[model samples]
Target: METFVCAGCGRIYLENSQRCGHCGGDLEERPASGRGIVYSFSSVHMGARGMPTPYLLALVELEEGGRILARLADNDEGEPSIGDKVVFSGLSDTGPVFRLF
Candidate 1:
């Protein structure tokens, strides 16, 4: 997986950003292990565009140290809880998606 590491403050982020939000410096692309745990999640009954109804969205706490929102592979995985193990599945045209590793 790929992420951006801030040259100014050494903050690693999963998104491709223009600059470091922390120190306003340049960013460099780097590889990450892409392991994470589900910190929090919710089901959206209504969605827009390509998103289907009653989908699961989770705020994953990346093992590399960043929190990102990604769609769950299983909407019917039952109620989500903190610390659910997950891995980076891939990227959607909309955003990232995750599944149990």
Candidate 2:
């Protein structure tokens, strides 16, 4: 199962689990309303712990109000920019990630 961190309160959640463990904040499977903007990003080239090289990581701001740091989808092209619109897809087995639409 996948897991996620609460943007509202920094609580961790299992995929099958609902709500924030620490704050009881409502947890949606995807970014609320399928809308968000890229807040920041980075390209990893080395020493990525358990991950492969050349991965794109980003912090995204949800339209409903919150920020989540996630990996960008593999199919994405070009560098993601601040304020670039994004949509939530499924979680990566290694981490949570969002795809650019």
Candidate 3:
């Protein structure tokens, strides 16, 4: 994946930007590690069409310092836990998803 990085301040954003939101400087696109730790998560019993109910939604703190709000896939490792290492698992129609590493 790619992230927007501020050329002036080095701030990273998960989304593309014409300019840096923090410094109003030029933004550049860079490859993202797509690796992070599960910061927090919640189970949603209700969701949009075709979305699996009772799926996990989480905040992943990327190794690059950028955080992404994404759906999480369960692993044989048991329930999701705070600070669990995860890796990008591609995307569903809804959004990007991650799996426990």
Candidate 4:
């Protein structure tokens, strides 16, 4: 039910607003098909940022369009590949972490 509008182009976005800063043309409410590739990733070793240490952070490129940065779920034991098919998980109560399916 949350909403945001781009300051630059006046685009309205629903839950997901990372891509469409303005002009909703490229915006999507959810990751298309829940499938995406791991565009990049990083490991957090410090808890200074308020997140648990040793967590994986990544930018996932959705199959349809747009990219989102999220935390890799604890259940994901295998390393993510660039073109791996990832399924969409529900919004996180803690942070933006998605489960790999």
Candidate 5:
């Protein structure tokens, strides 16, 4: 995944920015490892337009540092849990999608 890092404060951001919103630091664009642990998640039975129902949404803590909210790929095995390892599967209409690593 693409992220912007604050050169001054060492903060990472999912969105690109010329400067850090936190400390007015210069932002550098870089690629992320796309590996992380599921920090938190929720099962959504009701989804938005064009989105299928009964899907998993999670807050993942990247190994490099920083968190991202992404959609969990549909798994035949079972649902994901907190601390479960996940890897970037691909992008979607909404945003990034992650699967069990």
Candidate 6:
């Protein structure tokens, strides 16, 4: 996924605002490695905005040093745990999607 980095403070952002919020520096766009660990997650039984029910939402702590909220890909086996390795699968209609590594 595309991420923005602050030239002055090295802060990373998923949204590109053309300027950094921290140090008023220029933002540079970069590709993420798509590798991260599951920091936290929840199973949503109530769907919204056309999303299906019983989906997993997670906060992934990226190896590149930032966190992203993404949906976990459908897995029939089971749910993921905290600190489990995950990789970016792709973008869904909702947002970025991740899967267990």
| Deviation (Å) of 90 in candidate 4 | 1.8
lDDT of 4 by residue, 1-101 (tens): 23344545544443664667444445434324566677887777885666668877888776655567777776646676666566556567555565667
Write candidate 2's Cα lDDT for 62-82 as tens digits: 776667778888663678778
Sorted on lDDT, best first, the list reads: 5, 6, 3, 1, 2, 4
Clashing pairs in 1: none
Work out the TM-score per prediction: 0.75, 0.69, 0.71, 0.62, 0.76, 0.75
- Model 1 bad stretches (over 4 Å): 8-24
Lowest-sum lDDT 10-residue window in model 3: 9-18
Residue 63, model 2, lDDT: 71
Model 1 deviation from native, Cα RMSD in Å: 2.9
- Model 4 steric clash pairs: 6-21, 11-23
**lDDT tens string, model 1, 1-101?**
89898888877766878799889989999887888999998889989877668778899988877788789877445776789888898888758888876
Tell me how far the alpha carbon of residue 92 in candidate 4 is from the true structure, in angstroms, after superposition. 1.5
TM-score of 5: 0.76
Across residues 1-101, which tens digit of lDDT does each residue of candidate 5 receive? 77788999887776776989999999998888888999999999988888878889999888888887899998987987899999988878877889997
lDDT of 5: 0.87
Off by over 4 Å in 5: 6-26
Clashes of each: 0, 0, 0, 2, 0, 0
Poorly placed runs, candidate 2 (over 4 Å): 1-31
Which TM-score value belongs to model 2?
0.69
